[model samples]
Target chain A: MSERLNVSKTYKLYIGGAFPRSESGRSYTVNDAKGGFLANASRASRKDVRDAVVAARKAQPGWAARTPYNRGQILYRVAEMLQGRCGQFTDELRATGLSKSAATTEVEAAIDRWVWYAGWADKLAQVTGTANPVSGPFFNFSTPEPTGVVGIVAPDSPLLGLVSVLAPAIVTGNTTVLVASETAPLPAITLGEVLATSDLPGGVINILTGRRSELAPWLASHMDVNGLDLTGASGDLAVECEKAAAENLKRVLRPVEADQPTDWTAHPGITRMTTFLETKTVWHPVGV
Target chain B: MGDAVSVSTETLTGAAELRRFLHGLPGVDQVGAEERAARLATRSIKTSAKAYAIDLAISMVDLTTLEGADTPGKVRALCAKAAHPDPADASVPKVAAICVYSDLVAEAVRALEGTGVGVASVATAFPSGRAPLEAKLADTRRAVADGASEIDMVIDRGAFLSGDFQKVFEEIAAIKAECGEVHLKVILETGELVTYDNVRRASWLAMLAGADFIKTSTGKVSPAATLPVTLVMLEAVRDFRARTGRQVGVKPAGGIRTTKDAIKYLVLVNETAGPDWLSPEWFRLGASSVLNDLLMQRRKLTTGVYAGPDYFTLD
Candidate 1:
């Protein structure tokens, strides 16, 4: 029998739950860690960022309206889908210079991190909400609400870091437009496929794999985007993003430990979910 | 422009004559027309040209509120929006008209008395012209008496489909007679017409019956105002002018909610019907949400950043 030829996969941007090429019709070659050819990724333009923000905005209200328990189940389903594709993620991580064992560990940790964030979906209100004692004859209470669309720049830790930043924003019902790590974006695109089959609504999590520097400023300055996460940004880029984000008063999360790389395996606290949440306080007249 | 209307009553004397005149018109190549429209949509109007198109689109909007739950307060608010599209920016041009139901025309007229914005009422049992000829004429008469500058009448699709072209033509001519000085826009409700040939025939029929403008859809049907359908209508108006020397306007309402979609319609008009039909007098957009989108894009061009819906008033 003759040898069979391999059918290579094409990596495209995930916007509004469909995989479409960059509107600019631009693509760049992505090289593996060993300087060998890996694949071509869609080099998203400012228009793609704009489109992602629009999609995230359109999906925000409906996603936030879902019951917290329902949101939790959907997030948990994402972890299950990710687990089934563990081998592919491990292989992609290996191409990104991680050893076999290290790649396996990262994939497992990414799935586990997703599950942890899913657990927080239904219980976040209990921990963050409070009842206050007022001086007048009234009952006062404060509850957390999703802060609309969020723009995220995923760190280069590939699978684990991307999930660590993404799961928290969406588990709380806030839709996100994420710009994946430029050099290591294969894992993110693969993750988008997993999300597509996981029953998560379209436009809830738009993933664009492209140059972070070219795409970040557009997201920061977009007025419709309510919050921004600059985890992958450093130094001047981080400074630029903060300045542009100030134009719209976007709630921004600056990179933690800017001087050093983030340790993705460490415990990710509830701060990420809380950062993109707004507290709404209500006062009811007693015995009215 | 100097000649009187060439499509006289003699050309449309009876039902058989009207059918021969309409059926004798050229058949539309459905695939060719659709391909041309799709090709024109890819033209990129950027920078200064984009700014010009945005303002022009803003000026050509017929800000409409036709919901069954419409109130006087809602009509007044819509009228106010039509007059001052972007309250914060006076440089933004006012919309061409405010479209409402016939009963609310008086309220719209009172609110927009001196704002240079006209009041247009959808009449003739709008969205479905199933009512009698007397009732339809009464509907037109009431709107005109209420001070409406324009009357948008719906055609009897059932008559047009069943080879009763004279009935539809006579109804339009009668409503136009009632409109007198008011611009009479005839709605074909093309979504229910079912074919490109039907759209072309209906456009010619409306123009022959003294329609000041030929509008697509009532904004109440599925697939309202698509690019290909508008292309066919624009071509009909262009051809009608070539033959009769009378230029009519084209308005594509519904489903045009984005600046991109509106710009595509402008490009279609400019290309398919020449630049003469590019002005507000020659063209109008029958839409509500498209105005806000045009405003957001205008702000983005001047301010160098995107504008959000939170800043714009709710439609």
Candidate 2:
């Protein structure tokens, strides 16, 4: 007889620190690059997105209240978890059809990028805010704050692109409801497992794996989602999401023109961070 | 067996009459009651029936806001919501009543003055019936004087569970007398009462003492008004009417937050208690946030698409 069968894992959605099946009890097949079957990922429904938003909204206040230094530590812990799971990451990426070297390089950069963002958590406010000279008898200043819950459309590069969008939004204390790469959701769910073990609290980053068309429109029109990132949306779908997002005047980050994704490993700078931060300017009587 | 005296305890007075009647009552099977409630919950009601149930459930709501931090402003806003549940949709019926604490009864009464919706006040130590008889009676009288047309009194779970069934009966009778023309809704606080048997017994105990309606919980306690508990109480009221010609209402307060949950309660009432108990006169849901969900669902039924919370009133 063959050796004991491995306990297979069922890919589930990550919402508010728990791995739950899609409320609709739906799943779609995910195949490796060679079209070999891998596993099924939950085909998240709009109700799942609504639940994620509720959870993100619930966790955001406490997360935003944590000291920026503490948030930095949590993000760094995520990088640490990613590094420990480095072998697994490379393996998952390899099965997605990337060459071994490309897979290894992507895993390394993803970890490095997370570490890079971990440092930005505490520094973002000082880098983005300014003291203003005004004509009134008051001290005036402007500072960027977390803009509450953001809905992210993850780029198709799987591990690197998923990390590229998720790390920045959460580092700033804004909770996120993110859709993982549709075709390449394995690495994304694997990342979700890493996130569960990391010190980062649940709902700070919720990952739902489902169709971009079916899920993105709900996120776009969702009045609760304060911002939308359309990095992963392509062609007419991008245009449709932008149109829907206008209902609430959501702060939208559309893809670079002509259906191109940004270079994932390139210096992402504060663009990702600034995209989700709301600027609050304060003025108080100087002498009072 | 002398005063347990058949099922006609509605007219039965005295401690012996009430206790013998309560003890002689059949014991509730927890598994059976819960299973029946769960089974009824699985009934698939849709389209026109769903729309009707949503609207009917809205009409049966006692829009309640009972809190330590409740203020006149909150009570007034609740009253406004009770009168016009949807400011945008006039087709939506007004709630049956605006429920508040005794202190806010006057505010609720004044805000709902000409709206035709009654004011129901939770009195007699409310969530806990721990106050002395004088204070409890004063609480009831004050709410009634402040213009509360319905007095929701707690049945002293501590007294009821202590086997002092007679004391519990007299307290309700005393409160009922104080209620006068005002409807008296006795809250069993069944969560603390512990068992289905106790809930069934307490239901009969309150009815024997002239409770106009028997409510499940005070909306403060955990396990407040579960579907099974409400089903048991609905059955009690249904049986009570069959034994005596008089009718009493049943209110499953707290934790019923969705239109689906409310409709399930309606189904239980319709099938078990019969269609006679379908109207607001015979049934009610004591809830606060339930109105908003009902309105959202009502809008979903009106418009083909789902309604967002932003489109509704914050009250």
Candidate 3:
């Protein structure tokens, strides 16, 4: 398998290392902020959403089974790759309409946030969890785990919000199917390139670009999905998202109204490990 | 690097000329009506804020945060939440109406059926309000027909700044007619209006044209609502009450997040509108998080423990 080499085209969706077009056979262009066209992104359908879920389910056991130390190392490596490609992301952001200085700062913050999460992959369990001291002999400890497959509606305003939402989900363990902001989806799709190079197991993160009203419901109501984050949607769409998540008791994050600025410090650490955690209670026999 | 940068003598003069030309633009002297000042008084009328309560009619507008999921089930759940207040102290002011987008008005009205909460829809293009008047009117009519008790329309700040107050007034008056017995809240998008004087003038124009409540912003733009602008608006409301004796409400929406901010608004209302305007009828917070924080603080006061963000359900 290692010896054989072949040329490959890269304009395909990467899920579980198997590149495929959207099952819908549909593609749409992601435009720069100046209204110029960039590369085309596959408009994911309900079928692609299912395929991504399958890939994530397959990858979950092994990834979650890895020791925290190894997971942290891998995540750190991702931060390294992200740092190496900072200039590339900066250019994409600038092309997406952010001022040069804004783009640079955003790229740097995105990279730094990743590094922060990288350090967090191992430590989140301790910080966000607890060991209950009950009156029984059973030792019960609560550890945060991935919530399985996550569906994130990325903020319409790109850069900070995009990375802010995505990083928390994947760093813990729940794989994500993000509907990138329609107006600024290019930078998000480009992030997939960095994930691919960084040795992140495929399917841990899948980026889809399309109309929010079109694709979001499919992801929200999917039986396999465990959680939903509706940060970008406003007004009625937000209400629709809340209603959709209630179907399976999926954990929901409400939309942040326009007036409230994103408080970077109050960002949740819970996403890192809600899915994969099983909450086991162990007991030991004692002699008198 | 070899060539030294040089500025021509005429370039400096040209820059100065451009600045003077901009300052001399027509309608620059027009100050917007004091929407914030009027609202501050409304807060006082219900809360016993001091004096000036008789001149202002305080109307509370709510930006409902009940987001629905794609599933109609989720929609129903949100409907239930919207219909029921997240249980807490009933003593805090009762909102005048549950304000929402057109699509959710039906749900909001349905949820609020048995409750005293009337429904208000933020129509007429909303936040941006850049669409055609026909479109805006149609949106307003649809919301009203759909059971909205009030309409919050945004004045075309672009048109207003370009000295088209006639268009702005006509639009408000037209929407007011469509409203019939329903109320009207005209948003001036104060941040874009740019100055205290323009803000005061805009307030006067909206009230004179029949705005029941003059709101601050659409919550779409940054720096949307601020305290200083509110102060100027209160002064205008005081002046307007002195002139017309018609009590108008004020709504400063967008950026307000915490109890401290809410308290500051309450204080401003007491001082500006006096004690009479301080009630749920006159004062409201256009917020999603404020209710939660209020509930959390209320819980602490009652139970002596702080609740987690996830501790309470929307309903």
Candidate 4:
């Protein structure tokens, strides 16, 4: 028999729950490590980001309303799904520019990162909440609440960095509008597939693949988006998004260093998980 | 308090007359209306047009608070918001009106006393017209007496669906009588009507009975004020004007909660009803959340960036 034909996948942007082609109807060709043509990724437009924000805002209230234990279970499910699809992600990472060993390590680290944030989902409030020492006959307690919808810029390390950033935001019950890396988006999109199956509700994590410069500013200043993570953005791009985010006072996480790359395998702390959270304090009178 | 209604007597005499008049009106092609509304919805209104539309839509809003938990303070704040939607931006115009339940008309009037913004009240056993005719008229009379410049009255879906067309017609005419000079918006609650034919019939029925504006919903029912239904109402008004030479306005309330949704309705007016129905005098949106979106879009137009909801005042 003659050789069978390979049907390549049409990589589309993930917005809300569906994989829609960019509203702009544009795509960019992604090249493999040795400069071979991999596939065309959707060049997400500003409209796509706006739509993602709307979906994230819609899903946030319901997701945040869920019990913390359930949220943890959902996050763990995503990790389980990712671990099951480890070989596919490793191949995608290899195509993107990583060496074979590096690709496997990145995929494994990505799965571990999901598990890390999954545990934090149920522990975030207890570790961070505080009881205020008021002088009157009142009990004032302060605790963190999810800050509506978040916009995330997924970093260069497509698998690990993407998971590392997305896991923290959603673990705390905040829904996200994520812009995957411009050149390396396949792994992140594969993660989106894993998310779609892991009992995670649609719109909880809307992933878009495009040029960050074209898509980031809209999310940065989007009125409905409560927070923006620019951990993936560095140099002039980071500065531009930070400026735009000020228009709506979006809670932004700027890259710590101007040109430094975030080490995705490092042990991430409670910092990014709490970035998009608003601390609401409640006061109750002590009755006789 | 007396203004004559010039409805054609031949059509006003009986139920048979009203039914023939309503059914004789052109039937709405459900699929065609939905396709047209969807097409208009996709028309992109860009920067300059968006800014103009945001302000125009803001001016066309019937800023509403219809909850059971509503209070005087809430209505006052809503009225204040209607007068100045954005406290920081002075260039923005006030809203078209403050729509409240009849009980709070006085509070709305007191708050928006001299702002040139209108006060619209929902009466006639609103959200449902199950009350006795006299009680409903009393509700209308009380709202007008309390100083509502516009009255939004609900139709008894039971009466309409049960084919008692004259009862619905007479109820509207009676409320029109109590309205005095107040503009009357007849809510068809198209969600309950369920078909474009019924929505077309209800629009004609309301217009024939002297409704100054025909609204799509009471905002109390599900599937209220969909694009297709509103398009059918707009077509009815357009056709009515063509025949009677008297224009009526259209308001699509409920489920229209974004700047894009409001602009789509504007495009519906622009395309289906022409520019004559583009002003606050001719068109309205019965919504609350749409105002914030319009404000945010307006800010985006001015600053060349998108806006957050927290930057604007909440009512």
Candidate 5:
């Protein structure tokens, strides 16, 4: 019992702005990057996903209603807090087997990505699109807006990829249910801790850590899910996942080829936003 | 007259006068209240949010390498897939543009043309401006020539820090000249600047150097786009507008995720830049997923039903 207590690590789920152990009370050991047993993460249940959706739905409107500038500013604040934790993120990365410079770069990239998006919250509409020219007495213009609830598969490649997918989705306004990488899930879960402290509205981003292959298909086909990102799946699974996305046409970002080295400069903000955007053309009387 | 004693007293008085003159010099007064007031003025543009019509223009720079993507096609395909087919989504944001590395600018330009989408390229050795001046200029020129409508360039932080403000100013001014009709977004890369005072100084320097927009980061370093840094930059844009009567834009890129994050930026813009700068011309979001959730919520508000993922098609 003493040995168990000494080695046992407790992992909690972030839902509705609070950290709670899974209601199912199921626990699974997650190894560190070094193959050493690091912690026991909650095996989030289907009910937990539902609860998260409810919380996300509840928080959606006000969060969306906020001006983009304010959202940008808050995100900027999160970066400040995260910046203070550079040593922590770096230490975690090192534990994950990354070299010192690699860990530093990973942490820096994550923080930089946040700042990049922080500036975009209030400005995407003008640069990516414009008002439509309708041949009617009504005024019509299109503004790309947020999709309500998103189900994300945090990239299994660890820190950088995990944030790469997660940040783009939520930064633009959609709430997310993230299935973190099974093997390298610590950083993703740590992100949840960061979000919890950063004044983010609850349900905006809900993280679940377990077997990716187990939870992904359920999330992929789940009626509540609005988008899917498959950055970490195996080749065979990625194909099947695409077909699954067709179930509801969930916005699916297929995994990159294994042989290719990641370019680090793809337009993440645009690709992810388009997945959940719906074009709503408003019409109003012009002579009012 | 007591010649010797009076003469000594007179000399002392002259010396005191000389000390006061030296204290009144520009460098000496750099930290004075009047100087601080001027700096504050440069940082903030006072205004009422209601009067300002703030437009939210969001953009996405999908760093696939960070996501672990190796090829440009995969990156471009993803970007093409990311654009909304419908030009207008009442609920979601109409992504203002798609920003990519210059190497992929042509792809983004080709994918987005006639789709009502603009292509923005990160030039001047984006994410890092460690290149030579010639290389930076050539890079900017190439990106613009490749059909990039907006040029996001990073100012030389090293030179700026070394008090070579002239060098920093000259590089941006030169790049701005090369942009022709294209807009120039001068990135301060504020994380590397170290202090709000430096951030403020950099902001002023960029605007003075013909920057159409002053941005905060390269999205390449830690400690990117911070609220305090942004606040200081916003203050600079506001002051510049007042001093020059030429409105300069602010872009606080990097690490922003979620709707709450987007809104905070909006609030900052409204509070600092006033109502006029609220349009897309003045305000924009360099983001990836912000549009999707906006679309979903808008659907819910209008239809009174939660539209699942299938309601919208991916680009």
Candidate 6:
């Protein structure tokens, strides 16, 4: 019998729900934590960032228009799909240098975090919104609205950090263009597969794997992007992004405590979801 | 130009002669024309050439709004856009014209006065040329009197399809007469003509009957203005000029909604009809949404970042 060769998976960028190679046709070798070749992830260029923003901007209104309850159901469905793919995620995480137990634990926590955010999808508006008392004969009420397309810089904890940032953004109905962890992007690509199958709409979460420094500034400066999460960016890159983000007055969520490593395992409160939401206040005239 | 007029006077004598002349023209090889258009489309126009093409495409736009709901205010706004496509960027060139329904030509002319932007009105029961000849003639005359410097008249597709080439030819001639000094653009509504051969025939029929420009579609048809259809029309104009020493313009309206699509048409014009038609004077893009995109790309070229739709005004 002839020997069978191992069929390796190609790690391509996920834009608008389809896996496409970088428009610049550039790829960089990704090695496992032990310094062995793992895969060649697409080295996304600034053009990829532009394309991802376009897709995210296009999908945002429709996703935001989906009823809060429906969005909650869809998020829960993503958690369900992730639960079924736990083994694959664990294996990928283990390849990234985590122990077998650590990988399994991280995958479990990521799924739990997704569910935690999913529950908030329908309830966050109530908790954050307000009914104002005014002097006029008008019913004035304020509700939270998704802040259009958001650009997310995922932290180095590929699966858990990516899920922590992305789940909250979408649960609030905002679509996202995410730059995955540079060193460990294979897990992010795998998550894109889970997203594609999980009933989450296409373009709702476009994943780009590349140099964070190369891709982050374009996202921060893109006029159409309503919000930016600079979780993975640090040092000069973070400062440059923050400055560029001011060009469009984008709502920027700076990295915690100025690049202090975030403990992704900690209990994430509603701040992540609230950070990307804009409060819309509506007033109605009382009957004469 | 003199030779073309004489030829038209000779060939357009009757139905049989017009049919013989139109049918005698070369048949279009659909596969070849499509292949050539697709090949030209792949030409990567980048950097300085792209910047020039974008500006040239902008200048050639006939900023159009033909909805039944078009109001005078909307026509005024369109005229403003046609005059200054991007108020934020003074370097942007104004469009060639503002196209509207015949009734709103006055509004467009009022807003576009002194801007050097012509006001073009669609007339002759536009999109569907089913009206009587007198009504159609009246429509054209009304638009011309309303200060429309250009009249886009639709040919009676029903008459043309029924092999009454002479009737279609005479209708174009009559409308051209009503246009007087105003430039007359004959809309073939090529989508209804059914095939490439028919598109070729209609192109010749319109040009021979005294059309200043041969427009591809009314922007209301399903397959409005496609690359191959535009290609055949460009070839017709090129060959018509070669044979009669008269230059006719070509306008492809509808469904062209991107800087990329607009540039592809420019490339087609440059390659098929030669660079003589490259100017806004010889070729025009009849589109509304495509203008903003061209402006966006122009901004993208000038500034190194990709632009967003929110910055531009809605059409």
For candidate 6, state the interface root-mean-square deviation in angstroms to 1 decimal: 0.9
lDDT for every model?
Answer: 0.93, 0.89, 0.67, 0.88, 0.68, 0.92
lDDT, candidate 5, at A245: 66
Clashes of each: 0, 1, 68, 2, 109, 0
- TM-score of candidate 2 versus the correct structure, residues matched by position: 0.94
Question: In angstroms, how far off is B180's CA in candidate 5?
Answer: 1.5
Error of 2 at B165 (Å): 2.7
Q: Which has the better DockQ: candidate 1, or candidate 4?
A: 1
Error of 4 at A53 (Å): 2.1
Estimated TM-score for each candidate: 0.96, 0.94, 0.47, 0.91, 0.46, 0.98
Per-prediction RMSD in angstroms?
A: 2.6, 2.5, 22.4, 3.9, 21.9, 2.2
lDDT of 1 by residue, A1-288 (tens): 999999999999999999999999999999999999999999999999989888999999999999999999999999999999999999999999999999999999999999999999999999999999989999999999999999998898899999999999999889999999999999999999999999899999999988899999889889899999999888888899899999878889986686489888888889999999999999999998
Model 6 chain A lDDT-worst window of ten = A254-263
Per-residue error at A31 for model 5, in Å? Answer: 44
DockQ sort, best first: 1, 6, 4, 2, 5, 3
Best by lDDT: 1
lDDT of 1 by residue, B159-180 (tens): 9998899889989999999999
* Order of quality (lDDT): 1, 6, 2, 4, 5, 3
Model 1 chain B — which ten-residue stretch has the worst lDDT? B1-10
lDDT of 3 by residue, A205-245 (tens): 88777678877777776656778887767677778777877
DockQ of each: 0.79, 0.24, 0.02, 0.64, 0.11, 0.74
* Model 6 pairs in collision: none
Which model is ahead, 1 or 2, in terms of lDDT? 1
Q: What fraction of the true Cα-Cα contacts (under 8 Å, chains A to B) does candidate 5 also have?
A: 0.21
Q: Which of the two, 1 or 6, has more lDDT? A: 1
Top-TM-score structure, candidate number: 6
